[model samples]
Target: MARRARGTSAGLDRHRIATAAVALVDRDGLERFGVRRLADELGVDPMSIYHHVKGKAALLDAASEAVLHEVEIGAAEASDDWAEIARRTAHGYRAVACRHPRVFPLVVVRARTSPVTVAAVERLVTAMRAAGLPDRVVADTPGVLFGFLNGHLLARTGEGPEVPAPVGEFDAAAHPTTAALAPLLSDVGSVAEFDRLLDTVLAGIRVSAASG
Candidate 1:
């Protein structure tokens, strides 16, 4: 080994730090994650992490980026069918959330824009444009599509990967409609529920395309 520098942190890189940070957050969740905690997890001093990632906020961004990488877009994203691309992208996003329920929130709520995010959006619009959707529809596709995914996945992931406890019985006399729909509402995070609603969202997009 060569002579050491005056005072540099050793045996740590940005990727290693990011991977470890993601694991810590996955195990303990964002509320409890901290630079010191991550450093302890990595078996290093806190300053060593700072050397790689700058600080905690940056660390969170790094961790979020690392988790986002697990999303597998596959060949469907490259297909000519815009709706197919959208469905595949949605599945990938949900897969990431399911894999790391605690870390998924950071991927959305963070103010920073990630390249992975931007690329996914690009794929959506490119496929939409290729499908002959009008300009107005293509421009709005990402927000409208992601709104549904984010709202549903956040609730689903928080509920974890179990058969969610049913919404139980609701009185029909006082609030008939609410009572009747209660079971469906409580079925928040099921795979079947996600696919069913995602198809509805696709129908709406198709209407927009047809009208345009």
Candidate 2:
């Protein structure tokens, strides 16, 4: 491919810049991502990036938005089942996180208030509402669902130590349950565990909607 001019990102616009930024972050991670690096990848000077994206923070936000754009939330005509909609939406979010494990933390921690994020939230809320969920329950359900997914993804990414403390060494005499479960703790946080948890969550939402 012919190199883009050094001082001019000729054909690049905001979307193209954001797209490249996402690829760069996926490759290099947020810790090492910078305008200079992005410029280098694009075959342009660092200042040329500012012509498309505002700066580092805005660029990161754009990249995060790009990551979220990959999620396939589907349209209303596709499915009327609220549980299925929620399940698919949750998986879409999880898929992005899983693909970019290093970049996933950045997605989780940052305030995703972009238009794309807002549209996604609306889709989830709309699904719950279409399922005849109570107005208030519908309003809060998206946060409840995505919050669980984000928390779980963060844990899966090893945000903390595999074993935080030495619970295994604790006396089984005083805390038999804790000591006994310690052995199993290491095996937790699997896809099966996530499925079980999501099932429990959807069940609770159904009950709440039914009761309301």
Quantify all predictions' global Cα lDDT against the true fold: 0.80, 0.75
Q: Which residue pairs show collisions in model 2?
A: none
lDDT tens per residue, model 2, 103-142: 6777777746756568777777787787678998887787
Clashes of 1: 0
- The RMSD of every model to the true structure, in order and in angstroms, is 4.0, 3.8
Model 1 poorest ten-residue lDDT run: 159-168
lDDT of 1 by residue, 1-212 (tens): 24346575468899999898888878898888998787777767777677678788888888888988887887865588888999999998898888888888888787335787788889889888877899998898888888888877777777344644334344678878877777667656767778899999999999988987
* Deviating ranges (above 4 Å) for candidate 1: 1-10, 159-174, 185-187
- How many clashing pairs per prediction, in order? 0, 0
Error of 1 at 120 (Å): 1.7
Q: TM-scores for all candidates?
A: 0.86, 0.79
lDDT of 1: 0.80
Model 2 global lDDT (CA atoms, 0 to 1): 0.75
